[model samples]
Target: MLKEFRDFIAKGNVLDMAIGVVMASAFTSIVNSMVSDIIMPFVEAALGSTDFTSIVVKVAGITFRIGNFMQAVFTFLIISIVLFFVMKAVASLKNRFTHEEEEEEEEVDPTEALLTEIRDLLREEKQSASK
Candidate 1:
């Protein structure tokens, strides 16, 4: 129904997901530009090739662009590393803000507790006898 559809659209998770998708697309473009424009040039210079994508291999009449594949893999690695760090930082900040860390409680052995109580009782009895 219309009401159900409207409710689904109005959900906070749905809205967050929509925004995340938009942001991710924008971020992807920025990363792609950085790889192709900035990083690739340096890599190409080191390899002594101006156009790395143009590098190819021909075998049995089949041409394979190994350069393009390498570039794609490099770009993917950069994006993955960047996203990993970003997500780690975000998670740390979220944890810091959202919850107080639980202090670890030391476990007391029942035997030790019983011994402590007996020691206290003995100390009290000695005091009473001394009085």
Candidate 2:
């Protein structure tokens, strides 16, 4: 069990996943800051001081903060857009740094290789015979 665990860690998939998780966590903080600090202020200004969360109608004495819901929706949208652009930039940089390696030659089947050799030998024999 110890050996199996060691092998699993050695495979590097876990390490890659850890790195990805860390990067995502860091990216999330940045997006959250942008949404709360940068974008939300503009949205608030556009929306004005009229608190949407307070404007509610009671159907069966049920209170619904529509303004709060709208705020949540806008926050989600801004975060999504910011993350999208960040991911796009990351992809562009990754593409720029990591070039597409030349494809390796496909492995010829052993039987096919043998048959090719036989065909070449027969062609040579036929050529010699014709001469």
Candidate 3:
């Protein structure tokens, strides 16, 4: 059981997941900042009192802060957009490395390979004969 646990922990998939979780948490903080600190402030400045969290309404003894809901929705939107671009960039980088490896491993026709080997051998013989 201990050995199995150790093997699971040592797997690259598990390690990769751990690293991804750490990176995602860091990315979330940055996106949250961009939405709350930067974008929301700009949006509020333009709207001139659009702080939905502070706005509340009471109807039939039930109170609802619709503004908070709006704010949450807007924040969600910003986070989604930011994450979309971040993931897109990460995918492009991954594709670049994978594409490079694929190109390196590109299959060469056997006939072409054989012909090239023959050509090299012929060249070597020609050089030796000239010498």
Candidate 4:
């Protein structure tokens, strides 16, 4: 059981997930800051409100915080757009690196290729001679 647990923890998928969680937590803070500090000011200015979160509605014996919900939705949209661009950049970089690796793998030494063909021909000739 201890060995199994160790193996599980040592697996690449587990490590990658742990790293992703940590990075996501950090990324969330950055996105949250961008939304609140940078984007929210512009949004509030456009809406003619000093504080978006303060905008609320009152109903019959009830209170509704529509502004807060809207703020959350706006933050979600900004984060989604930022994440979309980030993921696209990462995918392009990954593809570029993989493409370079494939190109390197495809490049064969001309001398080695010639030697290989010669070896194959010699083998065929030897087989015919034996026959």
Q: List the residue pairs that clash in candidate 2.
A: none
**CA deviation > 4 Å runs, candidate 4:** 1-14, 34-51, 123-131
Cα error, candidate 2, residue 50 (Å): 9.9
Whole-model Cα lDDT per candidate?
0.81, 0.78, 0.86, 0.86
Clashes of each: 0, 0, 1, 0
Candidate number with the higher TM-score (2 or 3): 3
lDDT (tens digit, per residue) of candidate 1 on 1-131: 99999999999999999999999899888877876787667777886764548779999999999989976776677678767877899999988765544322355679999999999999999999999
**Which candidate number maximizes TM-score?**
4
Descending-lDDT candidate ranking: 3, 4, 1, 2
The residue pairs that clash in candidate 4, if any, are none
Of 2 and 3, the candidate ahead on lDDT is 3
TM-score of each: 0.55, 0.58, 0.63, 0.72
Model 4, 76-119: lDDT tens per residue?
A: 78778877887899999999999999999999999999999999
* RMSD, every candidate, angstroms: 8.1, 7.4, 6.7, 3.5
Q: Roughly what TM-score does model 4 have, to 2 decimal places? A: 0.72
Off by over 4 Å in 1: 36-45, 49-51, 88-131
lDDT of 2 at 25: 92
